[model samples]
Target chain A: MMRNKALAAPFVLWAMIFIVVPLVMIVWYGVTIEEPIPYTEIVQPDGSVIYQLEDGSRTTEKPWQKRAVFSLNNFRRMLEPTYLRLLLRSLKVAVITTAICLLLGYPVALILTGRDFKRPALWLLLLILPMWMNFLLRTYSWMSILENSGILNSWIARLREAIPALDEWLLSMGVRRRIIFLYNENAVILGMVYNYLSFMIMPIYTVIEKIDKSLLEAAADLGASPVKSFLRVTLPYSLPGVLEGITMVFVPAVTTFVISQLMGGGKVPLIGDIIQNQFGKSSDWHFGATLSLLVMVVVLAFMGALGRIDKDDEPHKEVRIL
Target chain B: MNWKKNLRKAYIGLIMAFLYAPIVMLILYSFNNSKSRAQWGGFTLRWYHELFTDEAIMGALGTTLSIGFLAAAISTVLGTFGAIALFQMKRRPRQAMLSVVNLPMLNSEVVTGVSLMLLFAMAHIQLGYVTLLLSHVAFCVPYVVLSVMPKLRQLDPNLAEAAQDLGATPMQGFLRVILPDIMPGVFSGFVMALTMSIDDFVVSFFTTGSGVSNLSITIYTMAKRGISPKINALSTLIFACVFILLIGVNLQDLRRDPRKGKVEKVRIPY
Candidate 1:
């Protein structure tokens, strides 16, 4: 018994140092501010002249002389309209991406798990294989495909050159010769869905695949049509996976900096872009910590709600066909 | 019924295309003889040659693989032992520990990255290999724990106890009984940790200093200056390696447990 406790000590210590301490540091930095530059008047060598102490503070000053003070300034800055808009836009884009992924992925998952589907594992592996590639490489490839004068546009140009009437028709429609696809919110969402669609598919596929076929058979025996059987038997059982999928897609979509940077071309700055700026270009750690805290709270609240729904479905496990 | 079946198959085909189109573009463009991604001049292996010889990229790849392996191996040991200890612990303390374990998994990656950056800044620790390794291990442990915990829950509680009762020492009982039973979960956990570590960018970006950059960071920095086709070649090679490895593993599993492999058509759930 004592040995078991002893064995746990190292991990516990590690968690406290790395996991617990880092979070505490974020909170600490978030709610605090460094002392602003002190202003003082100094007498110059010429008695009539006065000097301002701008560049240099006293070298002998105690470290506590420039103490960090607790402040709500960082949080207050977060409420600025620009920052708030970015947060709202991030949420909107994430929500849209998640919705699109579910719409596109759920059907794919269902079909992949179909009774007649052969070699489902092989198909599933194919779906997941792209994800193992470097995420940056994946997004960069999208840039190559979607950029103005890139593959799609060049193909369109070729089509127009082949058919003069097509060129005239496009000109008559007031559309530009080249369609610009990058550096916009739509491109960011496209990137998100592309990168995260597999995440949505995997979880929902796992859940739907686990559904007992006998339950569907039972539903059919009761005269339930295929759709009705699906509604009653499959949908309810797959809710946990759906919620899991949503969390998986939505969290990353909301928080991804690289996707927006690469695909949006820094034109559509999300909250993630802003937070990254604070740490990088802006160099405002306090403000960055505040934004991180806000994102953390939102994610936790979202997961907690999903977790409740998961717990409520626990009693229904016995109804599983397996 | 015939149409419904055809529709299902077509839908799967379409989604597969959607997922694979970018990847296919990447692989194709890797062989393009042009520096411009927009134009395909001709087919060539120049990028592959460049990929092999680029010292910066090769160094980053070395760093990434070392970090991935080391972090995964260390975290697997910690997480496996941690899971076993927590399983034996009382409910309240176990719940508390488990939640902490889940924190890194559930939190936003941005938050995790920023918080770790803050910790290093406050502690005045230089953000380099050690910080990178620590952050990787910290985040990777949760995945390991989650994987191993399920296997621990499924074990017969008295398996180890029975071995002990048979006059085996407690450590011997654990080695002979519990370890073998949990090997599958441990193996998966290690793989999961490795994948997460390798794929990581955001946490590694912030936690690692400029001198110590991983492949993801290298790619991100290169992105601003237009990603070279060498990256595409490298990715194509990686994809091929993983694909062959997966096929090999599946074949091995079929050989070892033919019946079980046939019974469970879908071997991995997540």
Candidate 2:
């Protein structure tokens, strides 16, 4: 018992210091207003401002007493159209990315599980190799590829002469044949899918592979088409993995700021980028907290849904990846 | 029957093409002699040579490699023991424990990153290599646990029983029987954690302080400023290293077939 206590103490202490307390602070800072706060900020669209409170209390004088005031002004600000837009944008991006990832990753996973592919291990290795590269570089590499006049566009340009119809189609789309992708929604969504798709694939592949070959064969024997067998027996058996993979991908992609900032030209704002901007630039911990709280609510709702879906006490069967 | 077969073939090809496209472009462009990153100005060995001697890049490389090694070593030791302990517990408590271990993997990187940043602040300490190592270990432990526990659970309990029956101590039985059986899982877990730590940017970015820069941080800074040619060179080197490790891991999986390889590996039998 004493030995157990000794081992457990460090872990308990570590979580207290590292995980539990910081979580407390995020909630706290999210509620408490901070420096350069929204007192009387007015914006004229082209960078002019007559900034004063609606109450007309102008203070160039530093008020020491008001320095650490905690307030609901941040939470109230969520009513703004801008914050609403950011939340909607983040949700849209996450939903589309998850959908695309499922579509792209499912077929790949199915192939990995299905027999007859020579050297399936090699294919998995190929899938994971880029994944092991430094992530920031991976995101930036998209920049190099998607940049106007970059390698991709240049390739398209070269290909265009050889295929005149392709060149005409590219021109008709208001895109230079040299460039099909650069600084757009497609780039941002594709980047997220590229990074997190493997997380989705690996788990689904594990589940699909674990499914009994006999079960699949039996379904076919019962006069079901191959696709029907997959949709009925295969898909239902693997719903746990789908739920797991979606949650795993959704939470991170929705909350991440780096990919959008680098790839999306910062022309569009997601809740993540907005929250980061508030804290990093505006120094508004309270509003940032509100944003964080919103993200937390969305995440919690998803978790709640997942909990209900997985309410069954039976152990979800494991599917070996081989 | 024919359509079923045809669909599978087409599906396999499409999947292969998608997986290979980015990597093929990456390798092809690395050799492009173009000073402009977009236009391929023909092939050359210039960037590869340039990558060899760049001192700051080399420093970041060294920092990243050492951090990966240290973090993986620490996580592996902790995780191996944690796996053993958890395996000895009853199923209900074990399920709860497993969920706790998987938390870091499931949580958002931004949440983890921001929370770690707050953690460093509340502790009132400067972020440095040590801070980075500690955070990496906390998360890496979970991954190592994920990899190790499955193998531990699938282990044949009777082997240890047989060893004990032969008059071996509990320690001896475990060391001889269970430990060897789970070693591949441990090794793979270690490799996974190592790759994760080395390649990670979000966690490293939040935790790392001055003089603790790594490869991804350097690239992020470069990207923010504007694109650079040296980034391609640096990335190419890192990609080459990752690709080699990836191929090595896949080769292990291939050779793991009992009929083929000398080592008859034990897997987590589902």
Candidate 3:
């Protein structure tokens, strides 16, 4: 009993410092103001330049001020349509990305567990290894594939030299116009789907591996077709994975501005983009905190509702929760 | 049935191809000797050489490695104790604590990043290595706990009971009896924490204050400016490292853990 108590003290201490305090602080800061924008310099492409910006909002004499008061303006400003639109964009892309990830991941997982592949080890490695590399690095990789001067364009140009029909088709169809799709929500969806697909797979595979083979055999015996048996038996059993996959993909997808900005361009700001603007570009840490806190609340609410609904049919209902 | 079976086979092949295609493109582009980033000039080792010599990239690599090591170490100690505490508890408190530990893991990386940024900045604290290390440890604890908890669950509780009956202190029972059994679990937890710490950028990005860069940050800045084969070189290196680690883990599973092992390692690895 004494040893157990000693062991538990460390866990509680670490949790309070690292997890609980940080999360609570995010809320507390949401209601307070921080620095205003620092100085700015605008340099023209030619050699001329102009410069301007306010001092840190909390400070007065071009230096750090004493005793800055807390302000609520940051929270109040989030109601603007422009900001809300960004939030909606976050929702739209997150939903689409998560939906696509489920579609792509589920079919692949089904095939993996349903039948033995020639090199099962290799397939599993392929699924997992991309996840272990740098997240930003992988996101950057897609840039080469999607950009105008990148692989597809080069390939088309090569094909143009060899095949007149293909060259003419490429010229006529103008497939190069895909460069225009850059900085759009589709890019966000694609990036999110690619990044989080494995999360979907791991959980689904966990559940799928546990499913009794007899259940599938019984479904087949009932005279149901292959697809029907899958829909009724396999899909229902895998809902736990789907539940986890949604939260895993959706929250990041919605809040991620980097993938969208780098891949999609800064044209369509998601909630993440706006929050980033507040902190990095705008120097409105207070506003960013407000936006971030709002996102946390929404996530909490979204996850809470999902938990309530998903709990109804979870396998080992006690073990899995958000 | 024959046609349907053929279609299924084709579908599986297509999926595999899709999975393999992007990585292959990345590798092929890394060797594209041109600076245009678009046109593939020819195969060359030029960029890899460049990546090695670049001061900024190297600096970022150093930061990433240091943070990864620190965070992994912290996660292991806390996570090991947390897992054991849950195992020893009666029931309800254990369940609640386990759930709380898992909560951070379930949250999205972007959300976690943003929340940490707010938390750090609000406290009027500097956001640098400190925040990054703290948040990394926070998320990694769950992975360590999850990995260790399963192995703990599989052990026969009777062994510990027997150890106690033989005049062993609780500490002695755990150290001599439980530690040996859970060493593999601890190794797995360490592996997961290390990989996660290395892979993370979003959390690090938000927590890291201005100018203290890591590899992912440097790569991100470059990519933002424009696509560079330099980044391709970096990606290739990262991919190589991950590939080796994945192979190592899979090989270990094959040799060591029956449930995780596949048919490939009927042979030996010394």
lDDT value, residue B44 of candidate 1: 98
Candidate of highest DockQ: 1
The pairs that clash in candidate 3 are A36-A57, A149-B38, A183-A264
- Alpha carbon lDDT of each predicted model: 0.85, 0.72, 0.72
- Provide chain B TM-scores across all predictions: 0.94, 0.81, 0.85
Q: How high is the lDDT of residue A6 in model 2?
A: 48
Cα lDDT tens digits for candidate 3, A200-317: 7766766776788899999999998988998999989988877877777777777787788777877767788777777677776667778877887778788897882223211221
Clashes of each: 0, 5, 3
lDDT score of residue A160 within candidate 1 = 93
Candidates 2 and 3 compared by TM-score, better number: 3
- Give, for candidate 3 chain A, the lowest lDDT window spanning 10 residues: A313-322
List pairs with backbone clashes in candidate 1. none
Q: Which stretches of candidate 2 lie over 4 Å from their true place?
A: A35-69, A158-180, A308-322, B1-7, B84-100, B155-178, B252-270
- Kindly list the per-residue Cα lDDT of model 1 for residues A51-126, writing each as its tens digit: 2445665433323345467999988889999889999999999999999999998988888788656567677878
For residues B179-239, write the lDDT of model 1, one tens digit per residue: 8999988988999999999999999999999599999999998999988899889989999
Candidate 2, chain A: TM-score against the reference:
0.81
- Give residue A163's lDDT in candidate 3 (0 to 100): 93
lDDT at position B41, candidate 3: 93
